[model samples]
Target: MLEEDANAGYRRLFDDDGLTFGAGFPLTGTNRSTPPIEEELRLASHAESVGFDGLWARDVPTYWPKFGDAGQTFDPWVWLSQVAAHTDEVALGTASIVLTLRHPIHVAKSAASIDRLSDGRLVLGVASGDRDPEFPAFDVDRNERGQQFRERFEAIQALWREEYPELEGEWGRLEGDLDIVPKPTAETIPMLPTGQARQSREWIAEHGDGWLFYHLPERTLEDYVADWRDDAGEKPYAMAIRVDLADDPTAEPEPMHLGYRAGVEWYRDYFRRLEEYGVDHVIVGLESEDPEEALSRFGDEIIEV
Candidate 1:
């Protein structure tokens, strides 16, 4: 089965037909100059109206001054809460949050709250984080984040299920006679782990509801999926890819980070391969010079496949 079909949260988002497209924002502005969350919500509603299935935001910290794209330029949860309220049925997601820097309780609370606010239309993609520059300011060690991420991830999961969850780890201790209120409508939020983050395949499969991966060749992705299935028992996985469409529909492919600069035809072929290789949904990131047109083109051309 495809990844969306297998994951409970994804199935809820995309329904039975499978593939869905979501627009990632700042919908219209840069990190340094975000217009307003309202503009993004408008774009999101537009996307849904035009048949895109979901929308996602990025968690960009102020301290990471040069990350260029401050991604949506707002607090992810708060922005998602607004979008959830305004839009009727679009799946709202955080393309990812940097989990290593924040407390597990906060992650649990914010994600649960968003899920509730959206009436259960939230997809939580989390990661160990890669910005070494921001770690010191938070008083967190850059080198130790991988280990910290594991401990915190476990704590959050426990908090979701076990009342008064007590966590003892090298990072810190949460000995709680307290339970996090408002567990996800599902037993837990559908958390997708990005890359390895020092987690073994066994750990990812057992812990992660799904895999959030970057680029891999078709054969390699198939192998990775098989390995993940073996380790995870029965779980789903997803990938994010960028497409830069040329004005010419037959432009040849050129490599970019985790994606390509190619024509819509190549994109169609590439997406088909991803599906054939068992990807349930390919979250498309349009980073072309023309964002609106790129989005329109993807919807008009490739989504038909």
Candidate 2:
């Protein structure tokens, strides 16, 4: 069986033949700039109440004016822990933590801590650095991000699975002398690599517990899923989409950044198609003036289908 098939977080949020849904954080309408984040906890709890399988938080360590987006506007670790306290039974995920910029030890410790705190509900999505300015700011070599990402991933796994693990790489050197505390609730925390992370498709298929990808057209997504199944049998495939659900139930789809602006009826059909295409989960970034109403409507109409 695939690691995702066995992971507690994955088990809670996905099934073999059907699709589950998660709401991205900074649930408020604010994007493009720093979100106030005042209502995130309340909205997250509501998402769980409405049967959302997971609540995703993004890791944006610094604001990049050029990038034009501030992901959740809080430290992912601190924010996730706070959100964990307010909700029950909802999987808490980091859409991705930039592994190449941070030390592997910290990522391991923090992820394990969240996993334990959430009672094995942590799904850690990791990535290589993306924002160009961030690499130089953190003093990380942009060209070496791929190598650093791989090394960090390996180091994190060893720390979680072995006691006093001895690891040597660019991240650091660990000689079986020191052990990282608070190992994941299970043998290891589920790690889903986001995007390519500058790694080969084969590498991701072999190493990741699951694959988290950006939104794609139906045919494109179907092809990607087929390739993934061929390479990594039975592992889950997840994607993120930005949606602006219209008030009219029969409104047709119009193109948006990563998704579409459509009605609840249209979304229901769209999501059913996604399920048929073997998408295991979707992390939806909702764009709405009244986010609460949109979320409730999506849960009642789309997710229940």
Leading candidate by lDDT: 2
Task: For candidate 2, report its TM-score.
Answer: 0.96
For all candidates in order, the CA lDDT equals 0.74, 0.87
RMSD of each: 2.9, 1.5
Residue pairs with backbone atoms closer than 3 Å in model 1 (clashes): none
CA displacement after TM-score superposition, residue 33 of candidate 2 (Å): 4.7
Give the lDDT of residue 239 in candidate 2: 95
**Tens digit of per-residue lDDT, candidate 1, span 113-157:** 888877778887788877767788778887887788888888888
For model 1, the stretches where C-alpha displacement exceeds 4 angstroms are 1-9, 13-17, 63-66, 170-176, 217-219, 288-290
Could you tell me how far off, in angstroms, the CA of residue 10 lies in candidate 2 after the best superposition? 1.8
